[model samples]
Target: QVYVNGELIGGCDITLEMFERGELQPLVEAAVKVQEGNQQA
Candidate 1:
């Protein structure tokens, strides 16, 4: 499984699929935005 900042994002299978489709970057960027928002809160 894959965890980002202790939250489970997905398992290896889904992660690999996202990478292959070039969708991982947006997901990562969104996650970063969420983290930044939380920090400002």
Candidate 2:
């Protein structure tokens, strides 16, 4: 799930695209990294 400013903004579930371009991979990874960084702060 994803949210912004305490409001649920949008999200996505497992899909076929993750296996195609591999673009989703980096995005998911980067998003997690940023979220972890935010929580740590």
Candidate 3:
């Protein structure tokens, strides 16, 4: 799932293991992009 400031942005299904692995940099980057978009608007 994607989120911005507690709002849901996008959603997907994934394994709990993958989520627990802490592989969140890409997701964080995406969230940053969303935040930037919101800021620009």
Candidate closest to the true structure, highest lDDT: 1
TM-score of each: 0.65, 0.54, 0.47
Candidate 1 overall lDDT versus native: 0.83
lDDT of candidate 3 over 8-30, digit per residue (tens): 54555443443566655566677
For 1-41, candidate 2 gives per-residue lDDT tens digits of: 55433444345543344436675657667778888999999
State the C-alpha lDDT per candidate. 0.83, 0.59, 0.62
For TM-score, candidate 1 versus 2, the one ahead is: 1
Steric overlap count per candidate: 0, 0, 0
Best by TM-score: 1
Candidate achieving higher TM-score, 2 or 3: 2
- Ranked candidates, highest TM-score first: 1, 2, 3
Pairs of residues at least 3 apart in sequence or in different chains that clash in candidate 2: none
Give stretches of model 3 more than 4 Å off: 1-22
